[model samples]
Target: MAMTPKELLNQLMQTEGAMCAALVDYNSGMLLESVGSGMDLELAAAGNTEVVRAKMKTMKSLGMQGTIEDILITLTHQYHIIRPVEKHDGLFIYYVLDRSRANLAMARRKVLEAESQTAI
Candidate 1:
């Protein structure tokens, strides 16, 4: 069975050193659901929506011909990932991780898997 939005958040939380996870609608910058250990996901969701929007706008202006897979923002001690879902078209997943303990490569792979199996 496909995972629910909440289940997707739960799975992201299971990633090593995961700090937070949220299902966001980039078009509206809204958080559909979330789970985690640090920060207010609602604010993060809203802020990241701008991030996605900016990139999309840039892509359009540049005449880029492909879809965005994800965006990674690396901080001194954390990694923030924004993954847009192909199946859902306009939805995205925001995953925050503690840099010291998270396996970024693995977390990214897992996020992709979860996105593929998630249901709207």
Candidate 2:
């Protein structure tokens, strides 16, 4: 079955070390929905939109081809992942996970899986 926005949020929370996650529209800087533990999801969603925009601009300036698979920001205590929704084109999923507990590869795969089932 396809996942609803809330169901996708819940799936993200189930991932090991997940702190927070949100579905964001980079074009409008709006969070469609969110879920997780300690974190201000609204602010994070807005900030990450900027992050995605900057990277995209840089890539364009450099004449890069294809699309971004994901952006990973490794903080001392947390890992922030920004995975763009390929199906929707301009939408994205932002996730924050505890670095010590997260499996980066697995988390990335899971996010991709979630993206595949998302409506928009």
Candidate 3:
């Protein structure tokens, strides 16, 4: 059976240091689904949308040819990962992790697996 959006996010949260996870629509800055707490996911989704748009615009201006696989924003205490869903345009997965408890490499791999397994 195909995993639902919530199920996929729940899987991401099972990662050692996951703080929050969400599926977002970059074009409209909408949160399609989310899990975990503390942070304002709606605000994060909207803000990240601008981040994605800016990066894409910069890439276009620089004449870059390839699509963005992921964008990592490392904070003092957290690691924010933004991965565009290959099968869905203008949609992406956003996950926040506790730096001290999360394995970045493993989290990245998990994200890839989740993306592949996700249908929308």
Winner on TM-score (2 vs 3): 3
Sorted by lDDT (best first), the order is 3, 1, 2
lDDT of 3 by residue, 2-119 (tens): 6788999999999999999999999999999999986999999999999999999999999999999999999999999999999999999999999999999999999999988987
Best by lDDT: 3
TM-score, cand. 1: 0.97
Model 1 residue 117 lDDT? 91
Model 2: lDDT of residue 27: 94
CA lDDT of every candidate: 0.92, 0.89, 0.96
Residue 67, candidate 2: Cα error in Å is 0.6
Per-model TM values vs. the true structure: 0.97, 0.94, 0.98
- Write down the worst ten-residue block by lDDT for model 1: 29-38
Please give the RMSD of candidate 2 to the true structure.
1.1
* Candidate 2: clashing pairs of residues: none
lDDT for each residue of candidate 1 in 1-120, tens digit (9 for 90 to 100): 899999988988888899889999988888899887689888999999999999999999999999999999999999999999999877899999999999999999999999999989
Give the least accurate 10-residue stretch of model 3, judged by summed lDDT.
1-10
